[model samples]
Target: MDEILDVVSLVLILIGALLCLTAAIGLVRFRDVPSRLHAATKPQVLGMILICLAIALSLRSWPVVAFLVPIVLIQLATAPLSAHMVGRQAYRNGTIDRASLHVDELAGSSETPPAAGG
Candidate 1:
């Protein structure tokens, strides 16, 4: 049982580390802000969750879980929100690649209405 737990823990940690590495690579390799945001947030959040799970598994203690549960919850809550804000900002700021978007809902909405006097 102990050995099994250790093996699982190791695998989880390795997978998490690999995910983090992939996120880093994606961050550097992706061209535009939206794509980069996707790369940065998605995998990184999963990676963090996996890493925290691995820590919980290794410790196998109620106290550790008490701490980790909140951490994972906070991370889950924040990552997407932060990503959305950044992506929205990028789109508004004209840093996102419009060509890459299949359908831009914000595009039409963002255009200012012509002044009545003009």
Candidate 2:
């Protein structure tokens, strides 16, 4: 049982490391903001979760799991949100190529506010 647990933990760690590496490569190779954001958030978050799981498994302690759970939850919540904000900002700034977007719902939305006393 202990040997199996160790093997599983090691495998999880290796897979997590590979996912992180892929995210890094995608960040460098992707030209567009949305694509980079996808690369930065999706796999990176999964990789972090896997790594944390591995750490908890190896440590085999309630305190470790208690610490890791919140870390995973926070990453799960924040990664996509931050990515969305960055991508939205990039689009608003006209840094992202419009042609790359298949459907831009935000296109019709106006950013400017109405005049106060008009």
Candidate 3:
């Protein structure tokens, strides 16, 4: 159904927009750098991805679909890597506080990640 598909696409777009809004809020309210980076990177990337998908579905042409798909794929592929590298660099540089970090998932991280100049 065209109407159903349109509604679904619209809803996905709205959900993506909401993800972006929450990401912005998290970026502002979060206490430290690592969390902020997580907030800014993951949700925003997902939001854009949803947006791209919405555009692709709406346009429904091979050229447009082909153009949008790889951008989404590349972003989906690379965003986490970018976030990990940046987060690790932040941790190494001491911009993130262990006290504020609820989850420290990175392997071989310092037992006590040094403070911003320790």
Candidate 4:
């Protein structure tokens, strides 16, 4: 059982490392902000979770699990929110290519509101 746990932990670590590497590659290779944001957030968050799980498993201690839990939760909470904000900013700034999006829900909305005093 101990040996099996060790092997599983090692495999998880290796897979996590590979995912992180792919995220880095995607950031470099992707042409647009939305794509870059996808690459930066999705796999990166999953990779972090996997790595943390492996650490917790390898350590096999309640204290280690306790420490890793919040890290994973915070990452899960923040990554998508940050990615959405970045992508929205990119769209508003015209940095992202409009043609690449299949469905644009924000097309009809104005970028800025009218002045209240007027």
Per-candidate TM equals 0.89, 0.92, 0.75, 0.91
Q: What is the per-residue lDDT of model 3 for residues 1-118, given as tens digits with 9 covering 90 to 100? A: 8777788789889989999999999989998877788898889999998888887777667999889888988888888898887888888677877666667675475555467564
Winner on TM-score (1 vs 4): 4
Worst 10 residues of 4 by lDDT: 109-118
Give me the candidate number with maximum TM-score.
2
Could you tally the backbone clashes for each prediction?
A: 0, 0, 0, 0
Query: Which residue pairs show backbone clashes in model 3?
Result: none
Off by over 4 Å in 1: 111-118
- lDDT for model 4 comes to 0.90
lDDT of each: 0.89, 0.90, 0.82, 0.90
Which lDDT value does model 2 have at 69? 95
What candidate 2 gets wrong by more than 4 Å, as runs, is 110-118
What TM-score, to 2 decimals, does candidate 1 have? Answer: 0.89
lDDT of 1 by residue, 35-79 (tens): 788898989989999999999999999999999999999988998
Model 2 C-alpha lDDT versus the unseen true structure = 0.90
Model 4 error, position 71 (Å): 0.5
Tens digit per residue, CA lDDT, model 4, 1-118: 9999999999999999999999999999998998899899989989888999999889999999999999999999999999998887788789988887899988986355576232
lDDT pick, better of 1 and 4: 4
